[model samples]
Target: MTSEKGIAAVEFALALMGLLLFFAIFIQFFIFFAANERATFAGFAASRVFSVQGIGPAVETSEKIDSDSIMTFETNRVAVARQIPMPSGINNFLTQGRGFSIEIEIPTFNELDYKNRLEQDDNDF
Candidate 1:
């Protein structure tokens, strides 16, 4: 009589599970990378607008860029909120002074284009 060994079956199952786990982690990393790229793009766009024409221009630029991209941008003056000590006389001016900051938030890859490719139906078409 011949007996079949279960070692091969167990090994194959463990290997398959490991492969699935690896793919899951890889997908997560890819999504994070894509989100980071989009966020950086939005920040750059906001900064460029602010540098060229100031905060008022930044608002319009952000609106325009937001329309074209898959991220949201917000501009604000946060210098006042910082814990840095203000100079005696300059404190009053600093209170009214407007420093600019931009926040960019991007959605996940699943929201933009799943399956690892951009949609051909975009305006580029």
Candidate 2:
């Protein structure tokens, strides 16, 4: 009876360890996914601002997203980047940082040129 109880306890401990490991991995994956989503949202928001308000304000808004994230603007495009924070225990082997970068292009429009083109099209018709 005593030996059987010890064996059961050992089995339970092993199962518990496996469960803990799975939980840790789940948490890490959740963090990576959430961070990527946030980075993508920030990129789109910045791109929207760039399309409407111009580059300066858009860059400023993106820079304010988060300290761990980076935002860059090039011509009519904006990109937001971020790194996911992993749990300390898994840092040695899985310490590989997960991150996401979202890039968006905003089209520029010339109102005068567009109007002229429209008029020429109407004349041709």
Candidate 3:
């Protein structure tokens, strides 16, 4: 029979490489999801802060967010995103950053009240 020495070893090595590649992909997805979850939480937290802090007289009180803190409140939530475990070229195909940024929109009570008043006036007519 022909020499088949180290054939099984080569096959095993190839299989192991495939498994490692799959595992790397799986881990990257996990990281992406985890970071997304964290970003979501931060969004909610930022909204809460905006709502709670941008209350009555806050606009008058603070120089920033003045004239209507509720309306003028602007901030950004930064989320650290992870690149898929791959070569630079492949990773670039996936994404090109160590993180991502999210902009949170907080409802302005003044605008809501103004709209509500307009609606009520229209209803009265």
Please report the candidate that would top TM-score against the real structure. Answer: 2
Better of 1 and 2 by lDDT: 2
| Stretches > 4 Å off in candidate 3 | 1-5, 55-90, 96-125
Number of clashing pairs per prediction, in order: 0, 0, 1
Across 26-70, the per-residue lDDT of candidate 2 in tens digits comes to 987787777776677777777778767888887677667745567
Please give the lDDT score for candidate 3: 0.48
Tens-place lDDT digits, model 1, residues 43-75: 566555654566666556555644333323334
The lDDT for every candidate, in the order shown, is 0.47, 0.69, 0.48
**Index of the highest-lDDT prediction:** 2
> If both were scored by TM-score, which would come out higher, candidate 2 or candidate 3?
2
Q: Which stretches of candidate 2 lie above 4 Å from their native place?
A: 63-67, 95-125
TM-scores of the candidates are: 0.43, 0.69, 0.50
Regions of candidate 1 where Cα sits further than 4 Å from its true position: 1-5, 53-125
Ranking 2 against 3 by lDDT, winner? 2
